[model samples]
Target chain A: MAAEAVLAEAGYAGFTIEQVARRAGAGKPTIYRWWSGKPALLIEIYARQPLDLSGTDTGSLEGDLVAALGRLLAFWRDTPAGEAFTALLVEAQHDHAALEMLRAFLAERSFPLAELFDRAARRGELATDFDLAAGLDLVSGYVWARLLTRRLEDDSRSLSSAARLIARGCLRR
Target chain B: MAAEAVLAEAGYAGFTIEQVARRAGAGKPTIYRWWSGKPALLIEIYARQPLDLSGTDTGSLEGDLVAALGRLLAFWRDTPAGEAFTALLVEAQHDHAALEMLRAFLAERSFPLAELFDRAARRGELATDFDLAAGLDLVSGYVWARLLTRRLEDDSRSLSSAARLIARGCLRR
Candidate 1:
């Protein structure tokens, strides 16, 4: 993880397998043995690698989404992790395997959020007919916007504000 | 545009600029001169591109979002364009120019949607504190879920259902 951090901070142009090996205190050949190259290693590092969603949830659906999304943005804002992942994600847009990996990542996490909406519906917290899928999309869509467009450094307020709107509007149906 | 059509139909490994020129009814040199390469050309096609949202309105917020999303997704499912753009978009994850171009394309479209929500707010249709950002994100996120997950084609009904859900839910507030 530390090695991934260093690489993300430096970028591919400045990346070195030997450095990752050094940072992880592992053998260089060991790193090489598991992966074909830097891109592969980068993808591995990006893989559902643990995101802390502890701060998410605040009683109300909107408040919960706000907390959850804020954590998500914070996860992407890591010094090396965010930038490297962004670049790799851009690269995945072209590479078949990378795109697959990216999809896997989204599927693993995005579904959980969709469930959140579904639960909200069942509880009568939201309209029973509310589209859980759309709710998920709305939240995911905002993240995608930040990643592909602004590439902004996520702050607590931005996530909360976005959550507020989604809660206020999308859940009403 | 034709070049994009061709490339999207064929993977980059199998794609040829000459073929794109022929498909586009333009000469190879002319295409090459403008793009200087394949990646460049791919980005240019989507650059400043627009997703027509004229028919999205359906009186209610959820209805409007569904109609708009349905219209936008129509291109992804029924046309060669979606397949082609996906191929190129997958690649953009790795290529710098591709990332920049796609970001620009997304921003161009997102702004209009954001304004749509704002207009709804002004009309007293939406909660004053609605998350416009989340609304915009949901619109694109559904498409991304399909494209990135490769489920858009296999599950066309899912899109419509999602649309229905959003249409009813988004306007509730």
Candidate 2:
């Protein structure tokens, strides 16, 4: 946790193995004994933390979305973990190798939700012909949009609003 | 035209003024004189071939978005400009100065469509407060998700689906 905290504060440009070792109150050998280098350390921090993707599943997609968005906003606003994730995400946008890892991570992490959309669609929670990829893109894309603009703090409510709007369409006629 | 085409073909990191000059049979100084550098040059070309965001107002937000997204997809699919834009955007994520420019450019170029949402909202078309910021995030985030993943071939149907789902509030009601 200490090592993770330090990396979040100091980006890759400023990150070093020694600083992590010093902050964690562990020897350099201890740090090195685990992570081979910077990227490895970043990846470990990313995995070590728990990210909440849970939603209420209120039988209505809209309700589930609203609850999930609250969770996302709560996590994004109050936690160092969220900031660290965003910081690392932002950092990866600059580095190609990091970007690849970031891409892989996003895809892998998001697969379950993709399956969820499929399940919802199969059970008539969504349109028969709805594009799951695009649906996911819209939800996640909106989140990233708020992030890039530094307007996430002021725009939290919109998350649930967006969720409600889309969920209506997916409901049975 | 040839020089512009070359920039579209080669991208920012892959492009050079001399190569364009040679390809276009134009003086290097002419390009350098009009555009200060490669970035400026790319911006000029990207702007010249702007995606048409206009379409018949289909009354519903979903309908209007479909029209707009259709145009954007047509542009992205039929042209090379999207590749150049993607390259510039990904590179800009890591660059401080370029990031500012990207935000400013999006503000100026992308926000004109608030009228689309405003039209719906004015007619009491939305269920709750629409988060333009969040909606924008989802829309752009999808593009970025693909770009970051190196999936540039993905169509604008994703955006169309996103705009529709977001307007309906699939996750937040």
What lDDT is reached at residue B36 by model 1?
65
Model 1 spans with C-alpha error above 4 angstroms? A1-43, A47-50, A79-104, A110-124, A130-133, A155-158, A169-173, B12-40, B43-57, B83-100, B110-124, B129-134, B154-157, B164-172
Q: For the second chain of model 1, what is the TM-score against the true structure's chain B? A: 0.72
CA lDDT, every model vs. true structure: 0.63, 0.62
In model 1, state the lDDT of residue A54.
Answer: 53
Fnat of every candidate, listed in order: 0.36, 0.60
Candidate 1 C-alpha lDDT tens digits along A83-167: 5566556546457676776666666757658766765666668755556665676677667657654455756666666666666
Best by lDDT: 1
lDDT (10s digit) by residue, model 2, range B114-168: 7777777776776565567555555566665555454555355555666666556
Docking class of 1: acceptable
lDDT digits (tens) for residues A37-156 of candidate 2: 565677666666665665456666666666665665566555544545555564464467766776776777676467556556666777665767666666665566555444546454
